[model samples]
Target: MAVHSNKTATLIVMLGALLLSSGCGNLAGHKNVDRGLSYIESHEYEEAAACFDAAEAAGENQRILYRAKGILDKNLGQYDSAVENFLKSLAATSGIPGDMDFDTNYYLADVYIKQEKYDEAVEVYDAILALRKRDKDAYYMRGMARLYSGDHDGATIDFNKAIALAGRNYDLRIMIYKALSSNGYEDEGKAILESCLNNTDPNMTNYEKGQISYYLGNNADAQSYLELARNERDMDKAPVVLLLGQTGEKQGDFNYAISVYKTFLAEDPDHPDIYNQLGLCQTNVGDYEGAVNSFEAGLALGNNEYSKALLMNEITAYEYAGNFAQAKTLMEKYRKAYPDDKDAEREEIFLSSR
Candidate 1:
């Protein structure tokens, strides 16, 4: 699973306005903080860290500074540090709930989720909802936390509330289904998805319909819808191509999947997730070297969400190519980076014998 970054473009813009209005006394500090956030959004973590350091030296607002640091730590998978920094940010707040407060709480909750502290995550979301009573995203996230914590009834109620608030939102519906289906509630998830298919929401785009069809096992319809959606102007092609490749894979056509991924990469080579998918397709076709190259290419794009998966897959590609020595070497590094991964532990044992 990928670590979600909270430094979105919208948030960055909001923060920029917030900092600028704080007066000319801390102008340099504010600019540094803003640049740090921009670097974070671009996945340039080292540059972001430098910018943050400069911001701190220039005496930026303590609350915003801590929150920005927390975001950085979270993106870098330092969950403990993230939690601590987020708490510090909250403590530095002026006892008034504002956008920064909400952002910090959301990021803190996300880090809690990453650490598998579901109850803590729920509490954070609860606080968020107490302030913003009609926040559908908060309800949806709380539902996930409840589901993960085994409070199925609470989860169901929250999910329903979220759905009620987000009328005709196919994306949110599909996300809700994914949360349920991945956590031992497949039948319930299927029912939610079925409702999407049956609803005559005119605002539903081809991509939304395709996503619903894909999850519901209607791959043919998914492919047709996704292909049409891919051609629409101003559409984000990454997701459309990704689903098309996945649909090809579901239909037992690895070559088609590879072709789809490669074509997309030919046009926009910056997407690390696509490279990860392409690498997996190559591995499926016994092109281990190609898989390794693809995975490495993705890893070279800085530490985005797919970095962990890409590194693991690269190690797997080496193993599949009969290069046990290289695989074991990579496994040692992987273990150090992700000591909690039980699967990696087992793989290490297997690789040791090879």
Candidate 2:
């Protein structure tokens, strides 16, 4: 039940902002920093790390270098390191809030949210809003922090402000609904979604319609809309196909979902998220070996946001295949990489007795 939202889009925009901001400074390490950023975009994390190191050796601007390191650390799930790097980046700033400063603050707040330090996240967002009162993203994110912190009324106020500021942005509406629905405000979330559906604008694409329908529990309608979106040559087919496959799964047709994923992969094989989804469907159908292969294919693509999930699923596939030895082997590596994962710790304990 994954909702296609603006979180990734927001990060992409932040990365672009960092690049643009860094260009303002004349530095010897600009090329290295640029190369590192490109590697990060492609999920070549280790390569990105090396490039960042080279940039540091070449005496990159401390602000840019620390921010780059913060981005990399965040991607690697090294939250504390990311927090430290972001703080260093802030310290290196000229005390003038620019795009880089704003971007760094957003990332810092995001990391705090991930850590469940909602109050800290709220304070960061508060600072942003004080400086740029019209920042809709800050309002929306602050609302999320408030929601997670159990301040439902305050969350609603911020959400309303965000919605008013970005009224035409259907994605923002969907994101708000998702946040509310996931945080025990289902009826309120439903109302927001239903309003979006009722007030359908002509400018809305089939993909947007499909997303709304899916969230509204209209699986059949979601599938039809997604298929239409997929057929449009101008549309990005990956998300359309992904959502369509999810619609199939929602309909209890795992085989259909698997076939959909396979068909898409046969044509466009580079989508890591698609590979992860395909593996999940394979696992559901008891094709543990196929699932492992799918997961491995995704891992080979590189370390994007899906990397941790792919590794964890790969271990689960092996466990389900009655290969506790292989599962334990993988789990040990996973534990080393992500020692903070309580689920992984429990899985390790379970595997030890097997």
Candidate 3:
């Protein structure tokens, strides 16, 4: 689909391939690895890592452990760690299976692609393609890698192959369109996006369509599709709302932004941003009293990163309500709390002169 331009997905895919290719094993190794999983389930990362390490050292399912650890690393923004773990997984299966498992290779390919190792990614993807002729993601991702690597003809072939297998997948189609456009086929590229959106029975996923709409400056349609996708709610339901809120803020639709931010806060109140946004929206609507209340509520939560900026907001709100005495009190407090903030110090100086 639109793919969120995430690096993690590609990394995970490559890591998956390596694990499947090399991680399958005998009884003792499996058992040790299973113990590591148990510890992971208990939220004891250190204990789990230790168990996995033991399993790895004892000739256990190092591949599996490595895959899990790679995923963990990716989630924690340790891309380098993920790459290391994934490479270790690959090395584990280098000669044993005689070839890469399509699944693991697919993940490995994705990871390599994210890391900008196009040739390595293509190598793994090619191996996967050889193993499974109809493997759509393999063809599609390789095509993308090739496109980025200045191999337009090769990229086109892989993309066409992916389309043949997964024609209904709009993401692949869009990539092909872009490739065509880059290769001096601008009319075809434009038509591709338009044709898919206008399809009577569009095989494309919702997010893919959303991507098309977003790029075309149809923010309403883009948001509508994205919201539709988020309705599935596989997790805390905060992410989708947060995304919508961000969009609304960007568009200056403060009321809609407030609604989305409020929904997000309902699920993740600990997030200071929602409060800040709510205060901002209320301030914009001339609801100064409400804005003050919102800032006060956020301050009470005690999580503000830009505490002085937030207090300055409060000062403005107080100035609006003609509460100069309380406003002065807060301004002094702001100076005390954030002495290093030049803006806050300047504002305190300006206010004291008044």
Candidate 4:
């Protein structure tokens, strides 16, 4: 239930490579490999893990196996294990220089950022930049590391370089603006966003405009822009749908939020985040049963990039429904599933007292 800032989404732009195929010739022929990729795309982490295990046992390249394991472990919140597997992946490819080089290093850096090891993350980005000088992702991610580490000037320089490299990419620029805004350079960020927001060029997508408005705290404008974006031909609906619900919720219109999120669910029932958000909105609107149902449905789908949030939401929904028995049961499950989560332990105590 934590509201994430741009800093918390440090790896958001970096995960594209990790989520896609491994592109290893040696591993491509394995039957289990395709199944694993399919499960990953479907957000079935458990099934993906099983597929990976089978692929590894059938002698998938150690480099590929280790990289896939690292991604899965990271998604499942096994950070230390992820670091270990990523390092193994790197070691497995040491001297090859072409197989798994960029993605392995990038994902390892992402895991370091998640662990708040900013210096380590910067070092990894440095390694990647050394390998390829013009890597825009490395520049952007290193900027995030520097931002969190309080090297604001260095971060600004990196962001400028990234913007130059990403030329005409409105989404990337908007993400940079959000990072700047959330990291204490709000005026500068708003100035940048305002330029894009004022652009009347047909090349400027409504989705980017909505994102800019949302970052600028213009929720009503964001809602309107996102709705128009959704109606645009051939536009990707997933992001626009989610942002519309978010804008409604931000404006404290839970009913409108619920209606839109449910509308999205009708066509895409497997999305864990929509269910998570819908559950929160239901809880806010005193629909405890619906909240619990939504939470449970999301949990049943397993980890969909926000494993911790889904688990905590379900526990909270149970508590809100006055079902302390189910809440405590789920709390125990959460504690076992995420043993390192001190926050959940504290929350368990608080819920017990209630």
Q: Could you tell me how far off, in angstroms, the CA of residue 116 lies in candidate 4 after the best superposition? A: 3.2
Q: Which of 2 and 3 is the better model by TM-score?
A: 2
Query: If scored against the real structure, what TM-score would every candidate get?
Result: 0.77, 0.80, 0.50, 0.74
> Over the stretch 45-68, how does candidate 4's per-residue lDDT look in tens digits?
779889988887677776677778
The lDDT of each candidate is 0.83, 0.84, 0.65, 0.77
Cα-based RMSD of candidate 4:
7.7
Residue 212 error, candidate 1, Å: 0.8
Model 4 has a clash total of: 0
What is the per-residue lDDT of model 1 for residues 1-354, given as tens digits with 9 covering 90 to 100? 333333332232223323332433233347787898888776677898999889887877767887888988887778888877777666555435578778888888888888899987887787777668999999999999999889999999999999999987878888988999899999899899998878757888899889999999999999999999999998999999999999999998999999999999998999999999999999999999999999998999976578779989999999889999999998887776565467888999999988
Residue-level lDDT for 253 in candidate 3: 87
Clashing pairs in 2: none
lDDT of 3: 0.65
Candidate 4 has its poorest 10 consecutive residues by lDDT at 8-17
The best candidate in terms of lDDT = 2
Reference-based TM-score, model 2? 0.80
